[model samples]
Target chain A: MEFLSERARQKLKSALLILSFFVLWEVACLVFKVSEIVLPRPTVILGALWQFFPGIRPHLIQTLYTTLVGFALGVGIGVVIGAVIGVSRVAYDTAYPLLVGFSSIPKVAVVPIFVLWFGAGTTPAILTSMVICIFPIVVNVATGLATTEPELEDVLKALGAKKLDILWNVSLPRAMPYFFASLKVAITLAFVGTVLSETVASNRGIGNLMMIASSNFNVPLVFAGLFLLAGLGVALYVIFSLIERRVAGWAMRKQDFAMG
Target chain B: MMAAKPDTFVPALPPSAPERARPLISLEGAGITYGRGANAVEALTPTDLDIDKGDFVALVGPSGCGKSTILKLVANLIRASRGHVFVGGREVGAERVGIGMAFQNPTMLPWLRIRDNIMLPLKIVEPFRSEFRAKRKTEFRDRAEALLEVVGLKGFGDKYPWQLSGGMLQRANLCRALIHDPALLLLDEPFGALDQFTREELWAILQQLWMDRKPTVILVTHDLREAAYLATRVCVMSARPGRIVADDAVPFARPRTLDMTFEPEFVALTQRLRGLIVDARTGKV
Candidate 1:
């Protein structure tokens, strides 16, 4: 095994940071002397985490599938539609006002409507996830595409480029930095959309389990579900970030690494 | 003599040969007015002008004096309130495939490598693009490399626009403009942003490139010395709502050097142009 000096040091530093947070948390729990019913101690939460993972393995897989599929569809449609509207003036004028109007309406307010229309299943969750996740991509990508430098546009025109070539080569690549930023927002929204869908409409996914645990005051499990949801959100975020890293390798050039 | 208005710009440049060769491009009775009614300001009055095949011309004038407007009119970026334009001997219309352009700012696409950025037009503009992926990719690349080498960007194909120095970007910008070898080359102060050293370097580079390519060129700039250095003919204009006041030929030798500006003949031409510009500023022309 090749053990690099800097990598080992970074690993040690991160581990220490995480350990420090846990220690601080444990100390605060003991000093407050709170009952297990609210804000369990570090050991209690860690134990609960171990038990919950294997027990809800099937539900975990189900939630993962719905979240991924919905995210894919939302991003796919958002990018294509956003790019279309971004490049065309009439389309931008006609559709942009409508999109902005729709986006202003709260996404969660439509959760029940989706359940009524699609019923309580993966469909509702996916549809809800897509709704929550798609708008930011559209807005961000469109904004990026619309705001491309006019001089560059002139260059393309002089070169004899058609609309499609301009969009594909000039406008689209320029929009990607914006697109990746929106993807981060989309990842968090995907989790919120999926969980909200499950909480409101589904009976089999993590959302339903949380609701059942809370209504019965199975306090530990409910806290566990909350923790689990946060973890799932982090996992999804990490995945989106990885995809961003893999595909948009060019963004590394923008790494001016701000200190403040 | 038939009554002719000085305010009018002719629709076609007269045939230089006076017989056989029609101008590759010409403007007849061209006028541009911005706004309407009380607010209207005429940027350029109706004026006649012609550009023969392979002519290298410059438009020199005060700021916002419609030197650029002339370029926009020719590029069909905008239209004149009156007059007809003919490019390649045909009336300017929707099927124009014969124009290349460069701007004051070196506006290369930032995301694309320099080579690909230059290749963008070929990806879209046809004849080339339609046959791009198949028969002409190698040919297009070789052409791009050759053009790059001409502009001193031979080894920078894979680098992005951001990585290039300003002079390099401008050189790349100039090459990109002429890559397709259009019948007309419209440059709007293409070196207006560079430092003195870089600008003079590009000046010679542009002169040589023009010599090599020999397209009909109309460059717009506020730099009188620049116009004197590179152009075969210099057209001066009046202030905003601009109009051409003088269109004087340089009558200097070919392949001119920057050192030529110190010579008596070049100094005389510059002084004469400066006097006209002073007259223009005073509304005395």
Candidate 2:
């Protein structure tokens, strides 16, 4: 009960901090008589958010769909590639430098290529998100498999475990915590990729809506779009975090006891 | 590699054991060298040793004396650089199907519950591997629970290894090694990490387990008192490029206790082995 109350107190404190920031912004804008085009007041942004709620829903859904689809593809391709590279030294040595080189190319720069190939719209946004998100999964999964303790492998081999059996029984379970950690980081990158592509060439998403609002000089509507994007990102991040806690709880629990 | 003459390198057979207790494992000038050419380093010198069926043999020596190399050779974890290793009266071939092993560290998979970890070998070896799915619902789980019970960890099978103390984890590790009913068990300092009291307790547990199953066991340890207390015979090895310098039988009777370690006969045996190890380490013998 004491721990529960302490957690509640921390949540309340964080809520107040956010509330104070908005209040301070509202007061500063009102005092300076700042132009709405230059810097909209918190009250104006809230009013615009209410007015644009129905208009924004479809755009929000479109952005969510593209990010999720791209994330799924990235995870599938990343796991297969990571497992192959991790199990064989030759594959790792040959492919790791190439992967690093590919990831280093700014994903936003690839958006134009994707648009040319897929002819603009949802396809480009999804492809751009996959390009941005795949690296973390590949890197984390490979690291997990490569770092299997030598003693554990020796024990399994002594028991007549083949390479495939070891992978299925030991390596895959060991990779879960790493895979879930990458999902948290990659989900954010997936959103970034979608928004960047939507701003460049897509016509019906939150990123496009923000661009249209800015061009029309409706800064309040642009702020509303930014707020909605943040909410979506936070919501998706929370979902992934919950799944991580469920699947990889063993890794976290193992650290509590000293080795003795 | 130079050839070691067969007549000079043969290990002595156990005179006290029954005549039918034939040698189950033998190393005929078996040795290991790491790397190649100029960088090559001999880890174990060409040496011969024999262990009889149902015998508990312990290898004791100074650190880095290649005691573990012998255990690895038997398990086929690493191939010999020269000569031959035979187990169960045949050359130990490509697949080492019925061998069990445990290391100094418990080495339990942190992701698995103790029950699943103990059942892991069954998912790999022999007829059990093929029947694992059907037996998982009945026999496989029963065997795991029974082994856990033998190690005094009856209800803890549902827990992960990390939840246990180091001694408990080591006990669980022993269960995992023995779960598959392997023909031979290799232990590389299995109790080397425990506190003195825990070590003694586990010694009793291991002694009882060995008495019950009677599997051919080769234990590699740095603890001389441990070697004297548990083994039917103890072999002391020389430093680096290691070979056995002393092979002495422990003439004590079965169902031994911690009390036996305090006996004058046991003390004399430990002191003798200790002096031999000291000499071996200092190159005196």
DockQ of each: 0.51, 0.74
Residue B74, candidate 1: alpha-carbon lDDT: 76
Estimate, for each residue in A156-193, the C-alpha lDDT of model 1 and write its tens digit: 66555566777777677778878998998997888788
What CAPRI class is candidate 1? medium
lDDT of 1 by residue, B183-252 (tens): 7899988998889999999999999998988988999887788999999999998877678899999888
Q: Tens-digit lDDT track for model 2 on B178-257?
A: 99888799999999999999999999999999999999889999888899889999999998989889899999998888
Candidate 2 chain A, which ten residues in sequence have the lowest lDDT sum? A251-260
In the range A2-48, model 2's lDDT, one tens digit per residue, is: 75688689999999999999999999999999999999987898899
Error of 1 at B94 (Å): 5.6
Q: Please report, as a residue range, the 10-residue window in candidate 2 chain B with the lowest summed lDDT.
A: B1-10
Interface RMSD, one decimal, each candidate: 2.3, 0.9
lDDT (C-alpha) at residue A72 in model 1: 88
Q: How much is the TM-score of the A chain of model 2?
A: 0.92
DockQ of 2: 0.74
Off by over 4 Å in 2: A31-34, A253-260, B1-22, B94-97
lDDT of 2: 0.88
TM-score of chain B of 1: 0.91
